[model samples]
Target chain A: MDSCQPDEKLDLAGVPCPQNSARTLIKLEGMDSGAMLEVIIDDGEPVKNVPPSVEEEGHRVVEKVRTGDRWKILIRRREE
Target chain B: MGIYLDNAATTRVDPAVASEVERVRRSAEGNASSIHQHGVNAAKHIEKARNIIAGSINAEAEEIVFTSGGTESNNTVLKGVVSLSSNEKKHIVISAIEHPSIIETARWLEEAGISVTYVSVDRDGFVSASDVEKALTAETVLVSIMHANNETGTIEPIKDIGRACTERGVLFHADACQSYTKIPLDVKEQNVDFITLNAHKIHGPKGVGALYVRKGVKIAPLLHGGEQEATLRSGTYNTEGIAGFGKAVEIAHTDDVKKMTELRDWFSKELSENIEGVLLNGPDTQRLSNIINLRIRSVDGNRLAAELDRRAISVGRGSSCSSSKSTPSHVLLALGMDSKEAEESIRISLNKWTRKKELGIVVKNMIEIVTELRMV
Candidate 1:
C-alpha cells in the first residue's frame, strides 16, 4: 500500500452535475494506478450517480459513507 | 425514454424534422449568398422556409427576419426598436414576469439611461391591459410583453394591450417564444409591431428562430455583416436548421395540441387530488395547455427535481436557465408567492408525446417523493 491518505480530494457538496461528476473524473484522470481519491458530494443523485458512473469508466469505488445530508466516497483509479 | 416533463425548457426534436435537417445538411448545398446555381437552390429553400414561417402566423414573408433563436430575436427587437427612436422617447414598458431575456435586457437598457416601466401582474400572473395603458405616455416608445410567460405559462391579453398601444401611438412587441406553434397568433389582428418565434420549443432544431417586424416599422439592425436577412440580421444562413424549423412548423397541427391539453388537465387534476397542500401558480383559464407550475408545502424545488430525475422523471423546477442561482423564481415571486412557496415550486411541462400512463407514473412518483422529502 502506498498510503492510506487519498492522493486527491474533491469537495462537491453544492456543485451541480455534469460539473460535479466532470470534476471528479478529471481528478481521477490525473492520478496513478490504484491511487485513492476522496470526493464529497451532495446527497441523493450525486451519491447514487457518481460512483456507478466512475465505475463504468473502469475505476473502483472502495468506500462510501453518509454524513448527514452529504456523502463521502473513496474511489481507486484503475490500472492503466 | 425518461418521462420528459420539461418540455417548456426545450423539446425533443421531432423525428421527421431531424430527418429533414439531416437530408438538407447532406444533400442541400451552396451558400444562400452565392449567385450561382447552388446558391440559387439554397436561397430558394430559405425563402420557402420564410414563407412557411410567415404563413403560420398570418404575416407576410417580408416581415420575418430569421435570427439565431428566441434570445437573439428578443434582443434584436428590443434593442433595434428602441435604438432607432428619438432620444426624448426612450421609455419602454414590460410585464414583471417576463423571461430573463426581456427582463435582463430591460435592466441593461436602464443602465444605459433609458426608462423602463415594469407593470405588475395579478395573483394569477395575468398582466392587466389597463395597467399597461395607464403606464404609457407620449415619451414611451415601445411596449414589450410576453404572449405567454415561460414559468407560469400565463397568457396575456395581447389584443387588449396591443390595441391600447396602437391607440396611444406606441409600438407593441411580444416575446412569443414560449407560445409559438403551440397557439395561433395574428400580428395584424393583435397590432403587434414585433414578435419573437423559436423552433426548438416546437420540436424543431435549435439555433434558428425568427422575428416578425411589421411593415413600415423602421428599426436599426442588430447585426451588421454580409447584409443577410434584408440587412437587419447578418450572418450565413443556418439552412439546415431553418429547413427543420419549417418542417416542424408544417407538421405541427392543432390536433396535437388538443391531446396535450387533455394530458395536462388530467395530470394536474390527478396531482392536485392525490397531493395535499398542492397550490397552483397561475390562472386556470387563458394559460398555455402544456405547462403546470405547482407548489408543495414542504419540499424543496431543486431537491425534488433531482429526486424525480433519479426516478427517471425529468422535470424542471423554475427556469432551467437560471436554476443555479439560489434565489427564488422571479415569476413566482411576482405572483405573490412567499419565499418558502417559491422554493417549494416545481414546474411540470407536458408535450404531445406525454401519455395518460406517463402522467399516472409522474403523479405517483411525485406524491411519494414529496412525502419522502418532507419526512426527511
Candidate 2:
C-alpha cells in the first residue's frame, strides 16, 4: 500500500452519502486508466455505500483504511 | 372523476396551457439558440413567454431567467447569491418552514462553510418581518422567505420583510410558487430582489419555472453551458414548456381568486363544523385562497391520506417533497406542534377549477373517515 502512489486524492469528510460517492466517481472518471485514487469519506453510510458503488462501476478497491470518524478508500480506475 | 385535492403538490395543467405546449412543440422545430428562421421562431415563443411571466409579476422582461421548476429557481437564488458573495458576507437568512429546496440547499451551504440563520415562523406559519430582521447581521447577504406556506397556506408578510431587507441592504428572495397567480405580487411595490415562480403550481407545464432577479443584482450561475439566460442560467431554452407557462399565466384571472377563496372557506367550514375533532392548522385569515391544512384529533395523517387515495380522492400528508418519509413535518414542528400533532396534519389544496361539489364530496368522505379512524 505504501509503494502505490495515488494519482488523485479527495477529502469528502463532511459530505453526505450519494454526493460523496458521486464526487468520488466523478474524480475517478477523470483519472487515467490504472491510476489509483484516494478518498476520505465519513463513516457509516459513506464508508459502506461508496466502495460498493465504485466497485460496481468496475474500479478495483485497492485499500480501505479506517481513520477515526472517516475511512480512507484507495481505488484503481478500470482500464477501458 | 376522481377528486384531486392536492393542488399544492401540483395542479392539472390548464387545457389552454396544454394546447399552447402542443402548438409550440409542433410549430417550433429548431432550438432557441440557433440563428436561422426556425430558431428565430422558437425564440419568439420563449420571449413571449418571458414577457408574460414578467408582466404577471410586474417585473421587467429582462429580469426573468427560466429554469426547470420552483426547486431549481430556489436553488439558483440560494446557491447563486451565496457563492458569489464576499467572504465577509457569508451568512443567509431563511424562514424555518421553507420548502425543502431552500432548506436542503442551505444545509448544503452550511456544510460548505457558509453560515445560515433559520428564522422561526409563528403558530399560524407566518414569518414576521421583525423576526427576520432580528436574524439578519452585517454578514447576512440574503433572506429567502416563501410567499405562502405550502402546507398551512399562511401567507408571509413579504412586503414588510422585503422592505426591511431593502432598508438593511440585503437581498430578499420569495418562493412564490404557491401564491404567484393567487396573490397580487408587484416586485417594485414589494421591494423584493428575487422571486421564484413555477409553472406546475399554476396549471402550466411541469419542469418550467423562472427566477425573478431584480435588475442590477449579480449572482453566480448554477449551470454552465451555452451562456443562455443572459449568462446567468445556461441551457437550451425549454420553449414548449415556457409557452405553456405563458398561456397559464395569461388565463389566470384575479376573479379566480374569489372563486377559490369561497370554495376553500366553504370546504373549511363544512369540515370543521361537521367533524368533531377537526382543527385548522394555519390562520383562518391571510391564508392562500387554495390551500387548507387541518389536523384531526386521534387520526394518523398518513393513514388518512392513504385511505383517501384508496377512495380515489388525492390529498397530501405534508409537503409532497418530504411526505414519503415518515418524519414529522418540519413546518408543523416549527409551528409549535408536537410530532404526534404534526403526524395528524393533512393538507388539502384547491385550484381555480376545483368545483364546489367535489369539495362537498370530500367533506362527506372526510367526516365519515375521521370518525372511523378515531374509533381505531
CAPRI quality band, candidate 1:
incorrect
Predicted model with the maximum lDDT: 2
Steric overlap count per candidate: 0, 0
The total of clashing pairs for model 2 equals: 0
Model 1 CA deviation exceeding 4 Å by range: A1-80
Overall lDDT per candidate, in order of appearance: 0.86, 0.88
Residue-by-residue lDDT tens digits, candidate 1, A1-80: 44547888978786534335555665787799889999999998678767876787788888889999999999999999
Scored by lDDT, model 2 comes in at: 0.88
Model 1 CA RMSD to the hidden true structure, in angstroms: 22.8
Question: Taking the candidates in order, what DockQ does each have?
Answer: 0.01, 0.01
Task: Pull out the clashing pairs in model 2.
Answer: none
- Per-residue CA lDDT of model 1 for B1-376, tens digit only, reads 6799999999999999999999889876888666444554565567667778999989977689999999998888778878999857589999999989889999999999889999999999999999999999878998999999998899999999999999999999999988988888999788899999999999999999999999789988889998887688889989899989999999998888888888888888998899888888898888898999988888898899999999999988798787879999999999998889899998999888888998899899999998898889
Interface RMSD for candidate number 2? Answer: 17.5
Would you estimate the TM-scores of all the predictions?
Answer: 0.82, 0.82
